[model samples]
Target: MEKWDVVVVGAGPGGSYAAKTAAELGLKTVFFERGRRPGDKNSSGCGLGQRWWRDFPEIMEALQGLPSVRKVEMVVINLVDENNRLRYRCGTTGSDLCANRWPHGMDGISIYRRDLDPFLADLAVKAGAELRTSTLVSDVIMENGQVKGVRTEKGEPVYAQVVIAADGAMSTMARKSGIRNRWGGGCTLVPQLDFSADPDKMDDVIGNAEWVWFGALYGAYQVNFRDGFHIGAGQWLREDWDEKPTDMVKKVLQFPAFQAMCRAIDAKPREYQAHLLPWLKKPPKTYTGGMMLVGDAAGFPCPLEAEGIWHALTSGKIAAETAAWAISRGDTSERALSEYERRWKASPLGKEHEFGPEFVDLWNSTIFDPKLMARQIQLLLEFSMLHPFSVVFDWGDAHMDCFNQHLEHLLDLAPQFADFGRTYLAPLARGIWPKNVKRILLSVKPRIPVLGKLPDNTFLRLVAKLSKSLAPYLDPAVNQEAPLPREVFERSRKG
Candidate 1:
């Protein structure tokens, strides 16, 4: 039995970050993983914002030396008709309309997790943390209703003053700690399949960018990478998921878009692996009590977007600071660790965490419906085509209120907007547009700038006005609890 100041289980982003930060702060940290090597068990590609690396300057510096696929601009999103006969595409970003734009890069960066994950693990070692591979954490050690350490597969006890569970999704530790049960049906399980292709052909197919597909490819979404492409889909499971991932990929390729994506890459799906992705609705109140839960263990995955890598890394950093605070005080009490939650609330990612559930409901429902998905793409096209500048830059960066306002604006166009989403939008578009135009337009620029760009103050006011109009249709009770931003009541108001 070797006692340590902090023991971090799972060497993925969260675990490695916790170990690195704590060790750098002079704590004796031990990081463990079950994988044979850092990248062995990791996936191939992921879509994430570059802002995630803002806190870890060293990580960003290293990214400069790695191969990257820059998505400086994006074209319109595509939505398919049921028969796959008609396709619609539209330009959603300003890079397509304007030649020059500041920060001339993708809104986010896409990387092969194999390369990126291992790189991050190495950073922990450089920061003074000892990382052990092939070590599995099977259970946690608890005494007097408090956690003390963890039990390993080798039957060894790795004791620590404090333990941080950065285990990825499907965390056995989280369940043992009673933080959460098996995730609910609302959680989306995504299986990713990676395929290799010729560099030139891959370049031509991917073309310096990436795109997300919804309600197509058998209603499964897809993303492409530089050396290859990723194909798979996710759905809310009402029961425990026991199906092999390879089978799921076969089922997903049945979708027309998935087929097209596979053909474009000039490859066949020979293999697949499954990773559990959890959608966390809120931060757990009691993630620490001599033990802390971060990353997917705490259900930090964004419920709405199905993206958790950034959240995992961010929480891991905060958990590290809080762990240090505990060690310096020579106490690992729940009260002391509360700073973890407090600091989290102050961070940008924390602010977004609060609305996870709301976002999840909206996205899952809207995205699952093919007709609604297509109309949404069409709506974006209509707006972006008309007001390229306003639609492009400002609309995206505006405050939450402005986005909510636009939602209301779209709702007003059709009285029963939410209710008649797919059932109406599909028929309406098919009936309204000439078949030829629809076919040609699907590949053209999509997205709209109807929300009108203005200075911050004026834009906020516009959002408030639209929110008021939505009051009649929305549930007053829920609105009151997490009040939608009104003109007079801004979520972030400065004096």
Candidate 2:
């Protein structure tokens, strides 16, 4: 048996970081990469978040020399329907589409996995950790319910004081060590298409901003780097996948604007790949006996963005810290390693998941379905991002037509808001709210009209009043009586 202080499985971002941190902490560290090299198994590329720039300065220093690095301060988002009709467009760094209070502004880095992994692995090697590329950890070595280390596919056993499993989302080590069984709903499948674009044309057309297309293919996105761009889409995995990810990627490429953009930039697809990523809606068991799981194996992806590099990096370092502490104390049992979960939860790594449930609702809602999302996006545009611009520009009859349609939609949605009160607010009022007042409010949730909760006659009157207020400024070309309150009531009653 070969013995070491720490054995880090899988040379992904989390595994490399664990090896790096463990070695820096004076532990005998070794990381295993099943691929020929660190980045070989990863999808082509994706964006790395603030944690890479702000939290890990050493990694930043290591990344400085790489050509694959492209730092961005803006992002472009497009919402399109199945008909190839563009529904809405927004940009993070745009001038006042809607006001926000982000202190850091929008900032991130786009890099290929091929570029990121090798350098990150090299950082660990530089910190005096051993690198074992092409080494597959087939199972973990356990003795009397305690993880002793890992066993290679070759059946060579490597013993260590602590084992950190950072393998991909479907981690064999995690299952073999009894941390978690295989997943059905806890992960997503992402299919990627890698393209080499004309660099100059890419800068001209794509620029430095990442482009996200929602509804055209929900969770569909593209990020530009030095010489190429990557397009990908993802959805949660079910036991029997209703939609094939490869088929979805092909359809995404067929989308009118996406295909046109490819033609403009002279893009050529060089690779098509797909992989599983963790998408945990609830907290996961990350530690057991002498083993700690980090990154994908531990389910640390962001709820909204579904990005995991930040979580991986942060959790990997924290897991290593726990390993170091436990090893020094000579207690490598489950009790000692449980601190790994504690430290992560106490850190931003865990707090980032606070809105997991809410976001997961959006992830599965009609908000991601192209046709249904189009209707919702129309509402969002009418009320928010597009409102200010419509105010300044005289878009003529088109604008008035939209105003009328939006009023109708708003009227349609009023009842749904009442349902919201019933589903969400009513139950909560039972606990914290006063009984009499709670009756007025408990009174709420699920799905009822927004104003439908009000005395029936009083509803939609607000919209008519607003229309009357704006009636004077409008030209005769626009119909002021379209959304009249009495007319709306008559329509509803007739139905």
Q: How many clashes in each candidate?
A: 19, 22
Q: For model 2, what is the error of residue 287's alpha carbon versus the real structure, in angstroms, after optimal superposition? A: 0.7
Report every candidate's CA lDDT.
0.65, 0.76
| Candidate 2 residue-wise lDDT at 302 | 90
Instruction: Say what the RMSD of model 1 is.
Output: 11.0
What residue runs in model 1 are displaced by over 4 Å at the alpha carbon? 67-76, 95-107, 216-219, 239-261, 369-413, 416-495
Reference-based lDDT, residue 179, model 1 = 64
Single out the weakest 10-residue window by summed lDDT for candidate 1.
486-495
Q: Write the per-residue lDDT of candidate 2 for residues 72-174, one digit (tens) a residue.
A: 6678887766576665677776444222323333456799999999888998999999999998889888899999989999999999999999997988988
Native-referenced Cα lDDT, model 1: 0.65
CA RMSD per model (angstroms): 11.0, 11.7
